[model samples]
Target: MASAEGIFEGRLRELCKQCPPWYKNPSLVRLYLLLIAPMMTTTAWGFDNALTNGLQSIDTFMNNFGNPQGSTLGFFGASMSVGGIIGCIVGGPLNDRFGRRPLISGGALLIVGMVIMQTFSSNFGMFTGGKLLLGFGAFIQQCAASVLVVELVHPKQREALSSFFNTNIYIGFIIGAWITFGTFRMTSQWSWKLPCILQLALPAYQVVMVWFCPESPRWLISKGRIEEGRQILIKYHGNGVEDEIVRVEMEEIMAGIEADKTMIKANWQGLKTVLGTKGNRHRLWICIVTAVGSQALGGSFVAAYLPQILDQVGLTSSKDKTLINGMMTIVNWLTAIIAAFVIPKVKRRTMFLFATAGMTASFIIWTALTAEYVKHGHKGLGIGVVVIIFIYNFFTSMCWVPLVIAYPLENVTTKQRAIFFAITLFSINVSAFCSSYLNPVGLAAIGWRYYLPQCCFNALMIVIIYFTFVETKGLTLEEIAIIYDGKESFEEAVHYVSMELNAKHSEAVSHVEEHTEVKA
Candidate 1:
């Protein structure tokens, strides 16, 4: 019988010789899906509890302020974003220095503590403080979980599996919304508080569950702990498949480490590294632009204020509005699940194009119907607005959520991944902060005209994507690195395996011709 290393080496040679280089191994994909499941559930709880249904629960708190002031509610809403930004900025360096498991475990515990406090808070100050803490935990998990996923998987499967984090978020949102809406009708305050308390269970479960999982193999390799990284991979995959996966991973790791050694270090080096080079600059700009576009499309605004928005559309009865909002959450989850499956099979650019186009059309219809209701007092127009809202969210699940996470990962190297994760999370949170404050103010100032700007944003996004975005459906991390480095064209980068095969064939033909002439 062949030794494990011998078997692995033989298989790898066959794979390199026979299969396309960019094809993702199935085992890596399954591992990502499994590991990300709990993290997604926890992260999703933050939004579902605070943004989606919790905002409506706090309406009484907002109303009691005796003015149309969303300042306090906005503060509470934006607090999480602020905490998330801080978390991302700090968590990146910490993950780089310490490791993924410590951060994940610590952040989960923090979230559980903060969420319990949020549930029991009797005053605004206490409630907002709890939110801040919750935000800190959420952001920590966001940065750690995403970067860990990227580090754990191969380059080809990285984007697809990372996209699952967002998919799970929507799924959690659906579950949180259902729980909030179902319970809210029974009693007002407890309805929201119950959901917040329920979130505690998730992190508590993670603290225990994550202990069973190993540290990221990539992080281990990056720290010059190759033997340790191999051990963890063996433990994670078991002896049967471990040797093959480790060989493949080690090759990729050594390449990345060697490349990273040439990079210059300085103050704000992460920022400079991303923006100084032409390729890095272009990628940085794309991430920022896409992030801003995604936020301005009002997906978060719609989510945060869904129950209230439902009420505005003439579903005034609390019970009815809650039920409809719950239904919308379910629909959002189902559609997002579809997108998760669809993303790997289709081009990233293609998904964004279809999603943005559909979202733009939905917003236009919604804006028109909302205007009709406000102007002419038509009841039927309100129904149309509600239907359009559903369409907007469904398309949103298909496009913005997945791409926002996946594209950023695609554009940066492992050395820049942590820093870029921080920047992307910061942009997302900042936009969310502004949106949380602005949505209510916009609703007060121009009614449904808030959605009109979003329509325009979506239209602009379609243009941006058409001109600037590159398709990254089937490329390996090395190939992606080459594309982002401007060392190769997108087409050439994606079809690199084919190029290699042709070169090898040509070499073989030359050798055979030379042999025939010598024999003659």
Candidate 2:
């Protein structure tokens, strides 16, 4: 029998032969539309970043919030990170038990109320409390929605869609940035509140529309609802036909589940399984590195403190700061979208290495430019800092912006994805919390020097990713197992699929020959 690796390659070729592109099919068009519900949830994250950055530039917002600075500003920024940490802990175990749709829809429902509370807040306590709760709901949605996109999407579209998924954060950022820009002129708290209200759009869509999207087929099959899972594959993946590609996909999914059965489900035993072997341990390491490195690499600095960074560089005008924030977000969004679409056409490891290296170089230059501007009070130097900021973002937008979720998903098995992703989110929250909480304090205390650590951290990441990261380009979630499992993991299932296809081909050839003989 051919090895699992050879069979997977053959299966892929066969799938391509049998299936049309998603754009050519009506069922696929509708399915992609439904995916929008989950995909848009990242906007909540992006919106919050832009909203806070914009609010800091507004004079009324400063007066209303008592001119928050130092530790107070740090906590205000970090509140969501704290809430996200809690959400990951609460939502991770329940994800496997309740399925993806409920967590996704329920999280959106929760955010709807939180957005309302945040929008109408009259005091710091009320506003921060609302933010904390909003983070809770958003992270819950993030944990499940990301998993659903990878599992439910047609395999042919998986890499592009999954990579594009994180870029949705930029969509939210764009909305939040522009809204804050439009509102900062108001004399009342309504300036900030208005942007908070606009956040309701995507979450509201998620609450209602996710119900219309199909449940993850892999989730269904894991629960023994095999026919329901098969039907989903037939409908979405096979374009409503029970074709050979669908059969092969089902067999592969089943084989993945069977291989994973030796591992424990959820809690401590699952954690042990994730770390029990060299391969699994490596996965955990990459997950942590991806989670923490993505945030700690100066992106969070710009996201949370761009207004302050602008102030140090001599562009203290609120209008100037907000405008730069809005424009930068647009550029970042476009870059991320382009990178996402290009993911399938390029190698994952190469993108990470390039993004991290470029970011490190951009940030180091950014630091020098900032120091020069602060020292000489030169507007030209400050402008150089601004330009470098965009350059830094371009590098991040190219890789970490899209792959942060997708690459980590590639590292673990389907069964352990929920638990492992929860762990990954935990690292993200911790790193993000450090960035959110400490960035303000550090900026206030050390000014331009604070950017130095991020530069160093980013430099280290380039090395780590180059040395440890594996290429996952053009592979399915199940096919990736062969990388760690030594090409022997799914041999039995591959053999079965091979034999089944061969038998069908032979039977069809026999029927054709019989028909020709009769006609003769």
Clashes of each: 0, 0
Q: How accurate is candidate 1 locally (lDDT)?
A: 0.67
Top-scoring candidate (TM-score): 2
Candidate 1 RMSD computed on C-alpha atoms after optimal superposition onto the true structure: 8.8
State each model's C-alpha RMSD to the native.
8.8, 4.1
Worst 10 residues of 2 by lDDT: 1-10
lDDT scores for all predictions? 0.67, 0.86
lDDT of 1 by residue, 137-238 (tens): 877877777777766654444556667667667656666766766675553666566676777766787776765556777677777787787666655443
Q: Which stretches of candidate 1 lie over 4 Å from their true place?
A: 1-38, 45-68, 154-159, 234-245, 261-271, 486-520
For 69-120, candidate 2 gives per-residue lDDT tens digits of 8888888888888889999997777888899999998999989999999878
Where is model 2 more than 4 Å wrong at Cα?
A: 1-4, 261-268, 493-520
- Candidate 2 all-Cα RMSD: 4.1
- What clash pairs does model 1 have? none
